[model samples]
Target chain A: LQALENIQLDLEAVNIKAGKAFLRLKRKFIQMRRPFLERRDLIIRHIPGFWVKAFLNHPKISILINRRDEDIFRYLTNLQVQDLRHISMGYKMKLYFQTNPYFTNMVIVKEFQRNRSGRLVSHSTPIRWHRGQEPQARRHRNQDTNHSFFIWFSNHSLPEADRIAEIIKNDLWVNPLRYYMMGEGVVRSWASERQTLERPSCFRFWIQ
Target chain B: LQALENIQLDLEAVNIKAGKAFLRLKRKFIQMRRPFLERRDLIIRHIPGFWVKAFLNHPKISILINRRDEDIFRYLTNLQVQDLRHISMGYKMKLYFQTNPYFTNMVIVKEFQRNRSGRLVSHSTPIRWHRGQEPQARRHRNQDTNHSFFIWFSNHSLPEADRIAEIIKNDLWVNPLRYYMMGEGVVRSWASERQTLERPSCFRFWIQ
Candidate 1:
């Protein structure tokens, strides 16, 4: 009877150890899954406008580029503009960038579409001519007079990206803005200096 | 009286528009905040036990080194052994590598505390001896029998840096696994495979 009782005690001790091990493993996995869920939720909330949803939901639409690539410029510019004709049918076409050297350094290209008399009218402004310092002539030419649409090349300093993105958020778009913080070395100055804003979401498009 | 009524109506309309705009902005901000929050949470949760609060938290810990200039042989054999007394208060140290040959590639080092009495002890087995292909007999002398940790060197086919990172994640450690997925040109050979198992919280000791 004593031997049997001792055997029972050994089994109980082993079970407790196993149970503790199981709990630890389970906790680790739970911790791992949390980050992935958060990243997915972030992408959905920050995506621009109703058109983005339409594109994401469309059966025909596909993700062209998954990761950042140098070829992104050529891909966007070289793609036959005809592919965009269909986009004009249902949604107003617009682009937005904040002034940030790393995030969206240059506007690259900004195209807008207007529905006039049942026909799609398109206009595009490319931020090519002005590379380094913005010439007064380019600034005057680049000023967005038509509030309906404009592309922000957040192609400037840290403060510039924040300022432009905030200005546009207040003035035009109905979407929330995401500010990309640089991880390491930063070079080049894009926008004039300004105080860093506390909250990234506060910048809304407010037209006076 | 008619003019006064018209002005009042205009004021009311303006208020309604402003209210609607506020609501839209509020909704967008909430959505945008989700992803940032998620990413932050992920960083917090999977940050590793030895690095912060949880199991085996030590006050005096050494940071991991990014040995980019050294080869795998040099990293494992020479670098880890150098100035071992300075790493911890006599506790064997473990090295973490930031090697992934795929999407994101980074090389980093981390030091952990020791717990000899713990139920499950981790062993980083010495897997790669003579660096891919030809056998160098001298390398075999330093093989680890204790098997307390594992270091994954990036596969050259999958961009040396990125592949090394992926292999490390698949084999050892959990969350905050710095790695990149394979791109078009990158390939994984039969030899360069993953080696990891679901182990509970453990210690890594550095030995010369």
Candidate 2:
């Protein structure tokens, strides 16, 4: 009887131990809590920068990089970009990456146009697309080269636009890659029809 | 004797089952493997996109978004970014992010000036910045307006540059927030720079 009692106690003890271990592991990796290091310190600190640069630039250690790859550390795997209807761990991480500021800004810009009826506001006419909600014609032509320059500049500079673009199918987001892909199409649709890309000396920022 | 034998068998079975469960849990969450559902589908999938957009764009839901917060989800935590001489989960994730394409390209651009000796090759003359260890002077002025425009544009479009700038105090990365903070100092540095904030016609892509 005493031997049987000892065996029973040992089994119960192990069961309890395993249960505790399982909970601890789940909390450590599965919870939506803050990470150990903060963003500013990670990005601004010299030591961290050194490691990132070395990991990225080292020919031997950073072998994951491809010659033609645009963004070196870009996280656009096919699995990562798929339709995420179901609730899986994959969905959880995606939720974190998608709503990030870069992607959201792209969405806002895409929505800057259409009204409640989703009508395309003509360039020549002044319309209160939002704000006061008044039907007024556009006072200034949106074709200013400066605006185009800014757009082009933003597109070329930030890979975020492309990542955000991958998240949406329709014209509901400002996709820099798609815009650049438009090529001459962009040159044709000038709201105010301000200036052209002529004059070789016209400060071509795109030529590298 | 029968009871003791039965008890022994039950303990063995329970031990095996617990062992199996522990392995399953580790493989499911602990290992650094790619999640299912491709990247494009994950972001572009209507269901996932809807959730993300609702979570991010909804003022009440995505209150975390500030200006240019896309990279906030980006996991360059300080400990991860630090010396990286140490091995860790943060190190592993950072390794994945840095060796990715976007980051490497940025590094190439950052190293555009260094010669074989990692010395600064001045921008006034024709120089082989990229070489088989040959030293040369730069063909054009790095301070050209076009260069300034490209740098300025990059700084505003993505926060990566600023984060990188923090990693290195020098001019390798163009940090917009820091530049903006310079304010009057920047204006003082540029005399021939022209500006026409005409008619409130500015198309700010940032304001949501």
Candidate 3:
């Protein structure tokens, strides 16, 4: 029994080492991918309604946007997710908006981080909603199941907000082009589209 | 509009480059982690009923296991998943078993790989059942929702098989200890247990 416990300890030690190595590799890749992400952002900005359409095309994110949210999304100029040095530590999301009647703020930022105690905590900038212009208050009846996307800005320490951030970081931020094409009705079949986009000739080189 | 197309093309080119680099990084890390995985296998082998308990503890995997399957799992000596050079190309799963009354084969191997046409294909070693001892033939009516785990050995070109392979590769193979602990009733609160197991001091070094 004592020997068994020692074996378990050895396994745990190995797992910790593997996890650390994985994080390091991930961090290195994130740094290498930064310039490409920046270039993508620059090109995507010139395309009108790119970010809004991409958001609408996402199944999980789309359900959260109401008609009023769509109106606000039209003014969205840029969407950026910062890994905050390392993805395991936390992430920050920035949504840039043009001068709009709904809010006085030009950019809304939401951040998730671990405190000193190692508990996950989150906070976001308050949306300076213009009087009688708050999207949350003017709920669309047909979109009863949906919550106003603006409400996401004020959501702190909620699982729903965490889920949305994950989708944005893992899905939308990684390959917005897929969603953008979906929104444009260009992708009639998902499987074929995915094959064309994801499986490049370069992949064959990795096989050995 | 023509210029927009050019920009989109440029973005796709960048995405392809990023994807290639990511795969290279992933392959490198997988190679580095091989020795640790082998060491883990050595330690885990001496622990009786470890793999069976781990399988029973997994929610998605548990649902597919019947009582008769449990009997067979008792003889399970080793479970291994080979990435087949690179994860993107495909993976192979090997289940090593001790000689038991139910079957003559000592090892069962299932492989998923891309064909010349880039279509995914799969094949597995046929289970040679001892006369009148096939678990699939003897269905337990009470376990209507569950399929015999042995049925997984024969499944080919199925999305369900693909999903199970993904779970085994990504979830089970990566951190079987979590499930093993859960099976032992040592982990009551998942969130707290996850924090204790996953968050090591080495993680702090990667933050900067």
lDDT of 1 at B207: 15
lDDT of 1: 0.27
> Candidate 3 has what TM-score?
0.55
Residue-level lDDT tens digits of model 3 in A18-72 = 5566566556656655666677778788899998988998887898887778988
Candidates 2 and 3: which is better by DockQ? 3
Winner of 2 and 3 under lDDT: 3
TM-score of chain A of each: 0.23, 0.23, 0.75
For candidate 1, write residues A41-153 as lDDT tens digits. Answer: 34433433322332222222213212221122222211111112222122222333344332333433333332332222333444443244333333455443222112223
Residue B54 lDDT, candidate 3, scale 0-100: 84
Q: State how far residue B103 of model 1 sits from its true place (Å).
A: 32
Window of ten residues with lowest summed lDDT in model 3 chain B: B199-208
User: lDDT of candidate 2?
Assistant: 0.24
Question: B112 in model 1: Cα distance from truth in Å?
Answer: 27
lDDT of 3 at A183: 46
Candidate 1 Cα outliers beyond 4 Å, as residue runs: A1-124, A127-162, A170-208, B1-208
Least lDDT summed over 10 consecutive residues: which range in candidate 2 chain A? A199-208
Candidate 1 residue lDDT tens string, B75-104: 221112111232111222234333422112
C-alpha TM-score for every candidate: 0.18, 0.16, 0.55
Model 3 Cα shift for residue B142 (angstroms):
2.9
How would the candidate models be sorted by DockQ, starting from the highest?
Answer: 3, 1, 2
Better of 1 and 2 by lDDT: 1
What is residue B120's positional error in candidate 2, in angstroms?
44
Sort by TM-score, best first: what order?
A: 3, 1, 2
Candidate 3 chain A weakest ten by summed lDDT = A199-208
